[model samples]
Target chain A: MIENVTLDISGERFQVFYRLRCEAQDVEAFARHICVEQTIEFPAELIGDDDIRRHVMGQVVSLAPLDDHSWRVVISYAVEITGFSLTQTMNVIFGNVSLMPGVRVDRLEFPDSFLSRFKGPRFGLQGLRDLVGEKHQQLYCSALKPMGLSADQLAQQAYQLALGEFHFIKDDHGLADQPFAPFRERVSRCVEQVAKANQQTGGSSRYVVSLNSPAEQIVEDAIWAKEQGVGGLLVPPGIVGFDMMRRLADDDRIGLPILCHPSHLGSYVASPDNGLSFYALFGQLARLAGADVSIYPNFGGRFSFTRDQCLEIVKGCTDPMAILKPIVASPGGGMNFSNVQDMVDAYGKDIMFLIGGALHKGDATVPENCRAFKAQVAALLRR
Target chain B: MIENVTLDISGERFQVFYRLRCEAQDVEAFARHICVEQTIEFPAELIGDDDIRRHVMGQVVSLAPLDDHSWRVVISYAVEITGFSLTQTMNVIFGNVSLMPGVRVDRLEFPDSFLSRFKGPRFGLQGLRDLVGEKHQQLYCSALKPMGLSADQLAQQAYQLALGEFHFIKDDHGLADQPFAPFRERVSRCVEQVAKANQQTGGSSRYVVSLNSPAEQIVEDAIWAKEQGVGGLLVPPGIVGFDMMRRLADDDRIGLPILCHPSHLGSYVASPDNGLSFYALFGQLARLAGADVSIYPNFGGRFSFTRDQCLEIVKGCTDPMAILKPIVASPGGGMNFSNVQDMVDAYGKDIMFLIGGALHKGDATVPENCRAFKAQVAALLRR
Candidate 1:
């Protein structure tokens, strides 16, 4: 009976390896609980019903004790159970079991058929490179910040950032449809200003406006950004569900590149032993959700992300997959001129250098600061 | 310059306290970084611009050392910044800074005007009691689980649970639209059986179906469930989103009481110092998102939630707010019939005791097991 559910690697079954930390006596119960919690939530007697068990039951591939307190529980589920639906797939992965503590989703291995169901990335690393017309060098990105500026003033900053030759200018994550600077007005003005600056400077800089709105209005805003010819759209998938990003990428009506922001998502990666790995969260999940660029905090910044964590995020973005195109791992948060070369040395040419306040420091004008920031990247790449 | 942006409690200013763990030298910079990261993204020179600083800047309230490595940093922003949108409110609370590690949201205090902008809960504790036609006892709830069962089998279980005079019968959180028991068919069948059993037993048992679907289809499913005349709906806001729950609670067309499931939400409360408090995640946030019954893992259960944490969640559910009504704090994970009295003693009459496997255990039939569970609760309350 136990041999009946033997996992066929070529078959349409998704394997999810969960690191379940529990006592030895509790290990068996924990493993069984996860099987029931992740798949069927009924009596074990039902598993005796062969038809029912095969359809809805999850089989524990193997369970071994990692330590006295923790056990590595590997479980596999039939892909048909997920219905090839992204939301359902997520539900299948961490639905009820995510409620239980010490059960971390260590790794997720999807069958080719399962991965094929998702439209990975509309514009990935190379596509983004082609869109910006920067094929060889690392990309440059900046943020339009300080929430109270009127649409005109914010546009002026966007124009300045573009003039400095930054490839992408994003709205700070905090910029929503506030009373001071409304969404439509700010996005329109900034988009226009970025266009004008690109025309003047002969550059292909993009203004990626924030489209973090209510679910009903999010699509409308995305379409508006496309109509206004925004370079890209920044979506905080953590606030808006990840599936929303997939929908955006799949919708041909608004087929613009997406920059996934990591807002309200720190808890998942804060604890190393629980939740998701940095590579999985920022890299794999972002790419799966159709992010052209996954933005995270860079190391040696005010943030707590270390160099190793940042490297994992990079691997998750660029690692080979079935058909999912690689995406850029854009790291920001406290980046400056002083460490741009170090960042370049660490990430090489595949990454995007996201500098914020460091570009504006010292006595140079905004455009001069931008030029200098661009020059720093160019010099490092040339070397 | 600081006086220009005075903290006006009457003028809709929301205060957020963050526990920033950092070295002594980094505290001031961390405080300033959060202010800029939250509001204005431009340089400090831009803050010097009276117009920009007056409207868009967040003011640092106070900073005090918590320990050798942590500091309590209080920051306030003008309510106008959030636009009173739940999505935006969450962004304002923990947006770009969520990428930063060790900055945990300790507390959130909102002005009445700000809190009044969004609808809280449709049915609180009293309303739910009124809905279920129960007046003077702690309510009892069970799950129709072990996912491999067919729709007819699940309906039979629902029928048996209702016949036993249980107050509520909910689909286990794992029951999505699987082929074994599709959403529409399973929900329809379960609803019919519960209604049939209620009529046969002269009872008012409600079957709360799980409506966790893709974003586009979730609303459609909710409407379908409502059209079928289901008692209540269980939504995993963590999988969907907390704001999406708010949207559902606000929509009049799908005006059904929501049972917010804590699936994929453990990471937020798993760590003591890093993420959200249990009360914040399960209680206050759940109530704010319109969860009529906020379900969490009970203390001394198979799950890791502590007794103190469970008590805090109860307070979060029933504690006084401006207009947000008190809701039922439903505790479930690892709960059994044997510990029903202990649960009652711990949580009292205002709580909803959610027992699952224990209800189906012993020599009794499924219906007989349910009756024994009801008897135990009755015995405890009658004492």
Candidate 2:
């Protein structure tokens, strides 16, 4: 009888242990129910009472309680599942429990056989730092936005921001295949402008175009962006399925780091007790789904998320799991140059400081404004 | 200049009319900025200053403010369009606004060119009532279980509940494709069992299987279920795209009323002033997305949705919009026979009262329990 469940909680991984203290007569039945209920939502009658009794799968190896009341329990069942994907494993663990009210999931554990094939993060902390040429400093990030712009106009903004030496510039999540600016034309122009800027500044500022095309267009867009020399992509995992992210990350030809945008995803993690923890959703899940950078609304922004929530998100991104990925926490919305020092102090050097609108609002010319914003970011890191 | 920006604000269509309140000096610039910002996200320089100036074309017809803060402003402009589809139209209105902070959407007025093709709901309120053979009575609903059930076991449960004559029996959202109980087998068994029970009792106990399959699989699943004589389907619009629901609703061959599940969708309407309003999301959008029934967590249930929020959802469903559809608001989670009277008084006849878990715990067997539950609902509706 296995009784423990192990889950990778957002901030840190913990080996959670549990002991199911049930009536002696119901102990074995309870153990079997947990084993099946954790992974699949199949009813007890479906598997037959006799078969459940035979399983006798009930021993707790570890139990960890999350900030939420739910405890992550790791239990080993005698049943063998072969050739199933990680998603299948996840479905097996908590598919049924998700439906039951008050049944909180703490963590999940995989045997070495399943874990070996599970690619955590392709280009992690050091890998991303090496790609961006930022070794122990916070990266500066911005978004090219206000959608109705033409391809040429979007490119110019990208060029200005890149030349100004913003480490990362991504398309606003709203910038999809709109008639005003088709995706290909927009990506081509933006990438070209960024390349020219890189040539002039000797800075490795990367433009991450939003890849919000349908499933069929996802691979094509990624491949096309790589061909056009775009550095990365901004993907909304909530809109495009999680599997799409995995496919993009696995594509060696499309080697650009994937920045996850949490646009329509707030519903899943918005509740304090229900849904998922912000860190688990944006950090662990995003990382596991293969995000090199995860962008969320900064605290004190228009969004309702608090400062502590933002910190927890950062912790989830940087904290150690089975694999350590330096997930650049790009928090945007109402961020400004004045707040750079405070952001640095709050998130430390291992973060991507994202600011938008404010950089373009001042009377300063584009290049001057860009340079000023970059300077402020650099100054904050020095502090 | 087009004055009206048509929007599908979570399924509630609003034709926004707003006057260009910018100064004469800034009107053209503002118009161009709005276009570029809403459509392309291009900077001013990238577009030739003259081209940008020329693109600021608008002819104001009339402007009026609604009872809401929103104003109805009409303008006409030669807007460059990339594609024209239901999906694209939705994108054109709300896509860019999603990025903008504090930009309250006004109203939407659509030209016949766009509006003519949209068939709001095929079998809305009256159609659903006719099918169920109840003109002015609340429907009783319940979910099957936590999952892990075998086909036979699920069928047995369905038989027991259907024999009891529950108006609607649905698959739990968590019951997706799994090895433990495959979707097709489970659907086939449950449908057959329910049909047998219906034959015996001559009751309208419809079985709504969860149809949260991928987009491609959606049509096939619906068609197959229809062929097998299943009554309806359960769709999670949040998990599956909203467009998919529209597609399913548009299909005549697979004509079945859809029950919209708020599975991974709470985040969008969870915050008070952040995402779409709850009524807007669960009621209007779900109905627009072609749901005959919409399910939300009842207040005092396992979820945190408030009583006011629940009522708003009901109002959104039954409200007389451009086209009135009878959207049956089905609230579940921890509801029991004891609360049937309160549920009826709160939601009224145009509702689907959902209760689960509690039925199985009663001393009365499945059939007797279901009969008593129905009697309770019937007694409440008589008032």
Candidate 3:
């Protein structure tokens, strides 16, 4: 994903490929606008220091017009500028520039120095595969939904799904600390139920709760949930903010495979020519911030991620970065039982098929649906 | 801003007016999609409980077609669905719904029960005006910029600006805990300089620093900064998140005016037909999340908030919302001395004139520029 130009520049730097929407004549100026806007944020002429100008500011390393409406402008900034903080890294990447039009982050090239600062994916693709003992086989995931369900109802669904051998049973993002099914009660009952089902079936099914608690309690709850035997976390980077998700992922004690949910992040990828490229957000950012399974809307849903965009997200997840491991691309929005072959053909086996609402369809019950999904996918894997 | 229709709904409900872009014939279905999608993400037929349908689920209160492509659809949900927390409110408002296209959050209606749950702005418009003893005067604010400055250099700039009687001086959002000028050093020196200036000129120029730290350290840093004598907090909700900002504002001990910076929030407003309305993000969300001073790009800046959009933000800041206090509209990006009267004409006097880099221009020194800007604005105020 990062075909970075070997820039003859000083010190450690990170490269950001910006797709600048500007005319042919305006490329250099527009690229310069990014250089200043992202760094110093002051008029270049007014910044009197030489080192600040040369070392601290962003440098436009490459610029090429992509047709008439846009140009690919790659800019490099000093790694120290970020202070190695995840939020500040975000502030440098898209911060103030997000407010302006005609620019979207295309790709990022991070040096190991910058990349090492983040604990990218504690339990990546291989870890997830090993957890389910489906190293080479396709993995299946589903959400417990129709949210006003009590803890007992959700726990029953979790037990049924886990018993039927779902690799991952996650809470619907809507099921937060709502009064109907409080986070503590739901996680407690479901984790217990999942353990019971895994014991009975000898299946390595994991119960993942949405760590969608308020900022104050999230970290504590993550620790508590891990202690309470919850297998993983359904971290909604959008609702909780990506940095908070990163914090949860990076913490050593609460190590868990994060299923990165694309909740509020739709804004970042909604605009075609602004915010960030789909790969940059769902793929690169998610993997870089520590999503073992980066969940996004599949192509066919009312949620509109094109087939090409979905492919790009897959590419983003699997792209080789120094020590950052490859992650599972969990495509969810409108997955159905019949489309398993199509999805497998498109994304290959490096995906955790997230069949949500569709799993509740047909005359089959939840357990039957899960077993049926697994049977069909297992058959396909055998072939 | 909330024009609620008196509905015979059974619970304490909050309303969200969704702008649905769809074919006229498909309005009801698209509206129904929002009702299910926002709350119960499962199929309506599958939800077996009656109370969940009648109480917990989102109801389509009204739907009216807007032209050929868009419809204004209003939906109400149980207030308890949010759990009365800031982040959960955001989740319920724009969680998974944000991922889907053809719908944008137009306006929000909150009942007194829900609105009272939030602390709102600790120091709203009157509190900020009271900070400078300028209740009747149009307030002026500025940002310290060109980031790579040493603590001493930034402190000197802060001293000059405050000495010249600018009501507030804030750190540039770019000025985080970068090695060049660490957060603690910068905040300490700037706050000291501003205090010295206040002593010399009998002015109340508060030094505000950006509370843009990593999630783990943000709250601690906020409390530390306040205890270290920093007058106000510039919270980039896009970085620290709105909920985190609300937490800071709501905390009784570290009570400081919050200057909400729209750093990474541009994506939410960039797409014309997706994400959220300008007022919803900058205005309503800012106020509801407890931003005492909501800063945004003024029109005529390269930053693309139009004149109309800027006006809407001002309306959002000043709009009456139950017991929630109104906030000051800080019009920023590309503000120049010559445009003071023009900005005054448009946004009126309740504005915090956020003059950034332009203050460094012309024959005048920084202190001289500040004095001259105040003089001109004071004359306009007198007139």
**Best-fitting candidate, measured by TM-score?**
3
lDDT of 2 by residue, B1-383 (tens): 11122321111222433334323444444434444444434344543434333433233445554334333344433323323343444444444334333223233454444444456566776787788776777777777764445666767888988888887788766566645567788889999999999899898888888876643356788899888878888876665556566667778998888888775565455433234566667876677667888888888765567789789888878876665465778888768777777777787777787877777764688788877877777776676
Give the range where candidate 2 chain A is weakest over 10 consecutive residues by summed lDDT: A7-16
lDDT tens digits, residues A1-383, model 1? Answer: 11123222223678888888878888878787777777766556634646446546777889998888878888888887785677778888877666677788776788777788888999898898899999888898888866666777779889989998889998887888977679999999999999999999999999998878887688888988899989888988888888888888888888899999988888888776678878778988889889999999889986789999899999989887678999999998888888887798889998888877776667787789988877877887787
Question: Sorted on TM-score, highest at the top, how do the candidates line up?
Answer: 3, 1, 2
Output the better candidate (1/2) by TM-score. Answer: 1
Q: Write the residue-wise lDDT of candidate 3 on A1-383 in tens digits.
A: 00111222348999999998877888898888888988888878876547777777899999887878988899999988787887888889999889988889989999987798787888788988888898787788989877777888889889989987899999987878887788999999999999999999988889999877877888999999999998899987776778888888989889888999888888888877888888888889888888898998898876888889999999999898778899989899778876888787788777889888877777877788888887887788678
* DockQ of all models, two decimals each: 0.52, 0.13, 0.50
Error of 2 at B151 (Å): 2.2
Q: Which residue pairs clash in candidate 3?
A: A121-A290
| Tens-digit lDDT track of model 1 for B1-383 | 11122222234477888888889999998888787777766566634646446545677889999999999998888788886788887887777676666777767777777778868999899988998888978887899877656788789889989998888899988788876678899999999999999899999999999877877688888888989978888988877888888888888998888899988788787666677777777888888888999999898886778888899999889887678989999998878866776788888889888888777766787778877776777788788
Which 10-residue window of candidate 1 chain B scores lowest in summed lDDT? B1-10
Query: Candidate 2's residue-wise lDDT over A59-145, tens digit each?
Result: 444454433334444565422221133333333333333333333333334444434455656776667788879887777788886
TM per model? 0.93, 0.70, 0.96
- List A-chain TM-scores for all predictions: 0.94, 0.82, 0.95
Instruction: Please tell me what DockQ candidate 1 reaches.
Output: 0.52
> How many Å off is the CA of B382 in candidate 1?
2.4
In candidate 2 the C-alpha lDDT for residue B216 amounts to 35
**Model 1 misplacement above 4 A:** A1-11, A22-29, A42-46, A49-55, A63-72, B1-10, B22-32, B41-46, B49-55, B62-73
